[model samples]
Target: MNWIILVIAGLFEVAFTSCLGKAKTTTGNEAYWWYAAFALTCGTSMFLLIKSTETLPLGTAYAVWTGIGAVGTVLMGIFFFHDPATFWRMFFIATLIMSIVGLKLVSAH
Candidate 1:
């Protein structure tokens, strides 16, 4: 299903962005490989997004995809990268998630 593919694509977006963060923290050959992985992962993510767009509304698809990516990235930063996880930050993330859900519920499949 297109929705399934879209969700996978969003997960890929998270993967690539996390790879980017890891790449920045490395050096030399390791960094180069991480960068390469990031590029490949991002490319795959975009390809899936394009495929999903064939059946889903463009605006809804893009917003949900980006929302998933944003939430995943923030969580990864807090859990893996030891980034700050303030109350306001968590609150906004929850709000973003709710919005994403609301969008999905309102969208005509």
Candidate 2:
């Protein structure tokens, strides 16, 4: 299903972002490896997004994709990157999750 593909693409987006974060924190060959992973995952995410968009409404699909990426990246930041998990930040993330669900429910696919 296109939705599944879209979700996978979004996950790849998360992975690419995580790779970027790792790259930022490291040095030399380790950083280069993370950057390489970032490129690979980013390309895969884009490819999957394009494939899903063939059957999905562009606006809805893009919003959902970015929403998934944003939520996932934020969670990764909190859990792995030692970013702050303030109440308001968590509240907004929850709202983003709800909005993503709402979009899926209303989609005509």
Candidate 3:
């Protein structure tokens, strides 16, 4: 389904973002590899997003996709990168999540 594809694309967005972060910390060959991975993953994510847009409204699809990616990337940062999980950060993340759910519910699937 388009929704499933969108979700997968969002997940790939998270993966590519994480890879980008990792790339920033490396040197030479390792950095190049990470950059390549980032490029590939980003391409795949975009392709899936384009596919989903064929069925979903452009605005709805884009917002939902980016919303999912943003949430997932933040969580990945907190968990894998050991980034700070301040109360306000978590609160806003929850708020974003609620908004995402609201959008999904209101969207004519």
Candidate 4:
């Protein structure tokens, strides 16, 4: 059950961050909606994630949340918004993945 909440929190984290990025691109009424979605999703997700990480390992939960957010944002930038496909940037993302994995391993020990 906590895992389920954590997953929802992760999704909300992605959605909110993505919406915030989109909000920057949007203008007028749509921008307002995007901003609201971003705020709401982030706020709600953070609350749930805090509750979740209490039961889960702190390092494990945080690493997962941040990993999801970072990866999701970059993927959105590339596939959805046509950001440049730079090898260096992708390579750094791989670094982030490795760091997250390392964090999880450390926490398990």
Best by lDDT: 2
Candidate 2 has a TM-score of: 0.99
Residue pairs with backbone atoms closer than 3 Å in model 2 (clashes) = none
> Comparing candidate 1 with candidate 4, which one achieves the higher TM-score?
1
Which is the winner by lDDT between candidate 1 and candidate 2? Answer: 2
Tell me the lDDT of candidate 2: 0.98
lDDT of 2 at 76: 100
Score each candidate by Cα lDDT.
0.96, 0.98, 0.94, 0.82
Task: Quote the lDDT for 70 in model 3.
Answer: 96
- Model 1 CA deviation exceeding 4 Å by range: none
**Candidate 2 residue-wise lDDT, 3-106, digit = tens:** 99999999999999999999999999999999999999999999999999998999999999999999999999999999999999999999999999999999
Better of 1 and 2 by TM-score: 2
How big is the RMSD of model 1?
0.6
Task: Report the lDDT tens digits of candidate 4 across residue range 23-89.
Answer: 9998999999999999899998999899888778876787788786787778888998898879999
Instruction: Please report the candidate that would top TM-score against the real structure.
Output: 2
The superposed Cα distance between candidate 1 and the true structure at residue 23, in angstroms, equals: 0.7
Q: Candidate 4, which segments miss by more than 4 Å at Cα? A: 102-109
Q: Quick one: ranking by lDDT, best first?
A: 2, 1, 3, 4
State the TM-score for model 4. 0.78
Q: What's the lDDT for candidate 3?
A: 0.94
Cα misplacement distance, residue 87 of candidate 4 (Å)? 1.5
